[model samples]
Target: MKNKKAVVYVRLKEGVLDPQGVTIQRAILNMGYDVVEGVRSGRFFELELADGNGDLSGKVEEICRKLLANPVIEDFSVEYT
Candidate 1:
């Protein structure tokens, strides 16, 4: 059987106010990192699944779309290996 791995990345939609990112950017500027412009935060998820001949990809995507991400405010992608 082949081993399967899933990698998920979640990020806030564009135009959203990212207070954390803004705060980090300000700190960097204060620390003399003049070239630092901005920062954005996101989430990463790694999952392992038993080999199932590609049957689990759809289910995983569904999980991400329905529960892991807010469809109105976030976007996510899943990669399998």
Candidate 2:
């Protein structure tokens, strides 16, 4: 069986409020970092998969939609290697 690696990135949808990111940006500005324009917080997940799993892409998307991210307020992308 071959080993597979998947990376999932979860982030708030555009136009959604992100308090954490806002706060971080504020902190950066307060620290006198003028070059910093914005900050966005997101989640990163690394998953290792065993071989012989059918429909790997489908499975990954399902996992992202079901458990890794909220479809209503968040968006996610999956990358496999």
- C-alpha lDDT score of every prediction, in listed order: 0.84, 0.89
Cα lDDT of model 1 by residue, 1-81, tens digit: 343888889999999888889999999999989997779988889988876565687878898998888889888988877
lDDT of 2 by residue, 3-70 (tens): 39899999999999999999999999999899988899999999998778755777788989999999
Q: List candidate 2 segments past 4 Å from native.
A: 1-3
Candidate 1 C-alpha error for residue 37, in Å: 1.1
| Deviation of model 1 at 24, angstroms | 1.1
Q: Output candidate 2 Cα RMSD.
A: 1.9
- Model 2 clashes, total count: 0
Candidate 1 local distance difference test against the native = 0.84
Q: 14 in model 2: Cα distance from truth in Å?
A: 0.3
lDDT score for candidate 2 against the true structure: 0.89
